[model samples]
Target: MTLLSEFQQTQLPASYANLDPATLTQHIQAAKAQLGSKLLLLAHHYQKDEIVAQADFVGDSLQLAQLAAKNHQADYIVFCGVHFMAETADMLTAADQQVILPDLNAGCSMADMANMYQVTAAWQAIQARYPDEVMPVTYVNSSAAVKAFVGEHGGVIVTSGNAEKVLQWAFTQKQRLFFLPDQHLGRNTAYQLGVPLEQMVLWDPTQGQFKGQADQATRIILWEGWCAVHQQFNVAQIKALRVQDPAIKIIVHPECAYEVVQAADVVGSTHKIMTTVQQSPQATHWAVGTDHNLVQRMQATLPQKIDFINPIACACMTMNRIKLPHLAWCLDQLVAGQVPNQIKVDPETTEKSLSALQRMLMLS
Candidate 1:
């Protein structure tokens, strides 16, 4: 893949840096006129406010995938999120239509934590120790190769919304299960399923070892990884907000650290958080703990009393890499009949990867 050069980044057109709304609107109109209406733009909530403002659809990973599948008329689907999201959209949508990611380097830190090589070695080690009892289950925030590996080992992909239910389902199928790539989500979900905190163990991929373990009956196995943005939310933040304004309701994502989640009044995905705020009639203030973009969007779209649980907002810097200039540049290249930075997963991997994703959609 030929990506942006360092020289290009430093020497972008001076016009782009100072694009006013009028000029931006003109450029966008010209692009649409050239590219036609058969183009769809999907933005994740974690994306910058400028990018989200132009998105045709905005939501979590699953919502974005489903949105792409339903837009059959679109000749191009440009994802404003990370690499995994574009790959997942490609796998779920029509094969001939193009799926382009604005920036190739915009990838999830949590997803990269586990890879095919490390997972294979870990699987072999688990079988050697526990043998038939350990089943492999993975979070959706992982690479396609990891998902296929899970499928081959008879595991499934779980999202934040369905993790607890999936773990309960996994235990019914196997005596024990290994949940990968987001230890906090896995551990918290399993603990909710009545699996003792002592029973849950973490598999450290770097060390190629597991955390201290007790009995064989522990169903949920966790990987030592996390979302850097979600990990920033703290119990202390919640306490300070409580002391300052006890009337405020603290809503957090399930991806937050266990103690922060426990302190939150409502726990859900980014989409769920938005819905909760939109429908609530209590008129109570809100302190949200999630990605910065979604929180900002809430503060902008809602006139109600709501604020961040943490005063200093934390953002995923990588997600901020996909700016409007990048989106316009990528689409402009495609419109000019140059296929640049088009993400194509190998056909063999796509076939198996579909199974893992389909299992989630079916069970969802």
Candidate 2:
């Protein structure tokens, strides 16, 4: 329940460092057996194979949060993802349920880009210029505070899987849509909806001004933020893949740059990318552009039928912070009736953020 600043000193015991991988795994399994259904461990797709192997449920942030929210039997929810994700689970779950993050330092850089102060200032400035004309839409990767801001302003939250649908719905409600903490996603989604490139303007939070043409009747105002991992995959990588194998299909997450997404043979969320690979023709080759861990998982899962390669070597370092040692330590603490790194959003923030989350769940 403490603020992130107050809980800055999240340190594990020195004894955890001395435990071997086998011992750590054994301890984790033992703790799980002891807690049984009362403990729920959630891992994001970007998490390492070891962490995912230990998770009771594995999916994207929204999927994990929805699972945590609906689980009435779980007393403890340990999220093996970034800080924002754990904060989201806290917002969605019942008041009696507790959510924990394995590492306090695991935070999304994109989410950190658009803090509440910058967002509040931008909202006020935009509204001052065009009152009641803008509808805010934040990606699920953002902090709970940003989601609360969107909800309080009559906006909705969206995930990569349902961004296009949610944006389409937003366009019907307001004259302009303001997407936060991920410019690439906003631009890619807006462009897919037939919004002209010239009509979209980038709002640079650091500069505190619009980057593109300000007078072209902007329909989508994209905040100047992006995923560090996805941005590494560029059009050049796709070009190289095409040169290597004309038959190879390139699939990328929508978080990639507009040019990269446009060049990709298929553009979708992580789930869609995985599904595409699963349903593809046997012995097909694929070049994937997303978190390296997820692609590695797919490669391992479909080893016999498909050959998967990372178009670029990139991984979300924040997600990778939740290693075996951290997981084992967290589970040990939970089993011993101690909750370390518990993530709890303020009551007011949770109330407002849930409104946006609920709206997205209904629409998606």
TM-score of each: 0.92, 0.96
lDDT for model 1, on a 0 to 1 scale?
0.79
Best by TM-score: 2
Clashing pairs in 2: none
lDDT of each: 0.79, 0.86
C-alpha RMSD between model 2 and the true structure: 1.7
Error of 1 at 162 (Å): 2.5
lDDT of 2 by residue, 279-352 (tens): 88767888888888888788788852333334446688888888898999999998888889988889998998
lDDT of 1 at 214: 34
